[model samples]
Target: MTANRELDDILRRAADGGRISPEEALLLYTDAPFHALGEAADTVRRRRYPDNIVTYIIDRNINYTNVCVTACKFCAFFRAPKHEEGWSHPTEEILRRCGEAVDLGATQVMLQGGHHPDYGVEYYETLFSAVKAAYPDLVIHSIGPSEVLHMSKVSGVSIEESIRRIKAAGLDSIAGAGAEMLPERPRTAIAPLKESGARWLEVMEIAHNLGVESTATMMMGTGETNAERIEHITMIRDVQDRTGGFRSFIPWTYQPENNHLKGRTQATNLEYLRFVAVARLFFDNVAHLQSSWLTTGKDVGQLSLHMGVDDLGSIMLEENVISSAGARHRSKLTELVSMIRGADRTPAQRDTLYRHLKVHWTPADDPTDERVVSHFSSIALPGGGAGGRTALSVIDAQ
Candidate 1:
């Protein structure tokens, strides 16, 4: 058989919902025609979601601290311990942010931040328990396996015990923050100080067994090859096959700015879109796929709706990590709905677990409040330009 014929067969099988092997996924990701690959992924999405409805989540990313022990090469958000700029929000300030999120109709809070050397499980326990006590209606889909590992080591406890304690302290679910790239070479190249990729997955598996669900994420464009990208997905797939703990697969591009890795290389628009389609086709076992407009532009995000991206992700009341790394894209609730409608898909607000909370069937039903915008206080990056302060933190005196 010809090589073209083999690629065609793989595309057909993927479009029909057949599980594609990692090798087949790489072939489609690299060799298949762009439109053909996207079409196949769109077919899969329509099959799973016959309603033709796209979803977005209203959530705030509450960065509790900017002091990190593992300062990654690709990150522009972390400051070393005792650095003049390093700061941790007091428990009262963190709770106040949660209160603002609740008032703004945010159903979830992603409390992610630097791995502070001083913050043990006790710190998170106090913070999370306080948030739950104040807002029981909100979902606390915060932290990741890396944070869990950090806390375990900090407190001298087992990983299992750490997860159990956090779950008891009101950690409803885990977000895939630290699973940057699961492949060893890329994972180490970017974040060598972090826990190993295997260990990250192990912590997640333990959390799953403990009955705490979570999401899986991949950070692309850190100079990894096509094969490594597929391998990253394979790692998550293998674990998902066992625990079924991952709720969604979120793949985003790496922003290169004000960081050690520098702006040497980044994922192109074509590469990102292809990965989105390929991710949808590859992870048949995973129920939902989210597109990241925070890193990628809105056009790419809106285009992803037709290319197998079911969720547009959060409005992100505040996001400092990616913004600090030079991601300039921002959106309001109204603009988000328009983007969905412009793509010809009905817009629906969803919770952390991909559950639809509100659906806007017509223009009249859409939200008009403009304050629900991304990055309420724009981040003042290293070089500095606009915006007075970083996200989820008190705005510095202008």
Candidate 2:
């Protein structure tokens, strides 16, 4: 078949670490046999990371404010600005949360949230500075282009300067939180109020040029066509080709439990795994591809290591966003180590920069850190923690 020849060529080129076009990527993503695709992708992964180590980071996703202006339909985490139930965590409260995370062995704190109307560059500068001052060792992996654009507009400055000010105030790296789909159709359909895909990449380009590295992310299963998914990867690859600032690319499925989109157009587990493999094959320039255990459950996360992922993502000590949307998966540090080992790869704890801190070779020598549990369920926060975490601050119904 003509299709078979095209796919065969594509897989050969891909396995050889050669670049494939968007069209070719789509063909492989949709048409190739699952096992065949996984084989090529795993080859690429081994070639890229030959160390045979599967990595994970210990961090806390601190949502500074649930009050947001650009309310995406797929979000159940954010409350509209001025809504009675909306609230922002005071600076000290955020610091306390960070302190708790630090005490529990978190080296990085992901400060992500809704675009609060009042928080501009200065607001972030002060917060980031304080977090760095209090815990100079904590990597402030916070904010992406969407928040940069919002803060720039709020402060009446350019995005470059916004990044400059935040970086100066100790924003060590950026988190690719707001890049929902990157393509116009699915992006607008889900989050019309957010910045355009081009604009997101533009801001990241500026960040990359400024020596500030960042990770990129995608939220799939939100009614996007296979072609659109490939388009998203292509857009990211083009940007990575120029800047080389994206440290990793993370793709997660959209949860439809409590969001406005309401379970209408979610990607299946098969599609998620396929994209993970396709991303590995496509993003040859990017160094790391992470598998999301939070959204897709543990089995897929383990399988992703064999497919294409070198990183198991963060052992989130505190996560409210995805948990709010009904992602209930959780694990401890030992559990994660076991998962990686079971996948036939050495388990390692990595920093924000993907530098391995500790690598385990033998199962008998595995770590026994009881304190390093996945704090998603039984988080030590007040108001009953993440499992029953309602809101950091909520207003009276009146």
Candidate 3:
């Protein structure tokens, strides 16, 4: 068959609810026409959502520490152990942030931070228990595979034991944060000290076995090739087929600002949308495909809704890691709703696990009564800017 016919056949098969092999996915990524891919994927998206409407969630990303033992090359957020500016938030401060998030109508808190030394599984248990105790309604959808690996080591516990302890303490789900590039070579090249891609999946599998669901993510626009991208999604899809524990798939561009990979440009808007659409088509088992407005701008985000993304990510009451890496796109509750509505979709506020909390069909119908504003707080560095203090605040209105 010709290339166009081959692409058409793959799209047809995918649309007819058949799975695409990794080789076919690679061809679609490289050879499929942009509009053709978008149309095929959008068809699948409509079949799943059916409502011509997209959605978004409102949550806070609470980074509890920046002091990291594993130094990933593509990261601008983590600080080295002796960097003088490395730090961890006290448990009280973490609770205070949780209280603030709850007050702002945030139903979910992404408690992400670097792999801090000496912070064993007990530390997370205490923090999660305290947060849940104070705000039982707030969803603690936080941490990732890398942190789990580190905690297992620090506490001398098994990965299963560590995950169980944290879940017992109130971790609702694991955030797929450290999945920078799931293919072996690129992941190792960028994050040498981090857990292997297989190991990361192993942790998620263990969490899934423990009845904890997670969202799978891929850090795109890095140096990985097209085949590697498909490989990443295929790996996740295989796992989902077995465990059915992954709730959504989120692919976002890598911010190449402050870290060692500074010379590389971030993925373009077109590239991001293409991946978003392809993910919808490829990951047939995963239920939700999220459009990341945090990395891609709002216009691209809006476009993605029709292209295959159903969720527009979060309001992000607070986000520091991506911002520190030079992602500047910011959206308020009003603007987010407006974008979704403008695209002829209904915007919904969701919890960490993608459960629909509230749906805003129109601008006049928004349920959030709190004012939105941005906070300005700093993360203390031991020596001071390389290890310098980085202050971050959330956009809130009150």
Candidate 1, 284-326: lDDT as tens digits: 8999999998889999999999889889998887778888888
Please give the CA lDDT of all the candidate structures: 0.88, 0.86, 0.80
Better of 2 and 3 by TM-score: 2
Tell me how far the alpha carbon of residue 374 in candidate 2 is from the true structure, in angstroms, after superposition: 2.1
Which candidate wins on TM-score?
1
Pairs of residues at least 3 apart in sequence or in different chains that clash in candidate 1: none
lDDT of 2 at 122: 93
lDDT of 3 by residue, 171-274 (tens): 99899889989899989888888888998999999999999999999998878888889899998988998999999998988887788989475677887888
Q: For all candidates, what are the clash counts?
A: 0, 1, 22
Q: Best by lDDT, which number?
A: 1
Ranking of all predicted structures according to lDDT, beginning with the best and ending with the worst: 1, 2, 3
> Against the hidden reference, what TM-scores do the models get?
0.95, 0.94, 0.92
Candidate 2: stretches off by over 4 Å? 1-3, 376-398
Task: Select the stronger candidate by lDDT from 1 and 3.
Answer: 1
Better of 1 and 2 by lDDT: 1
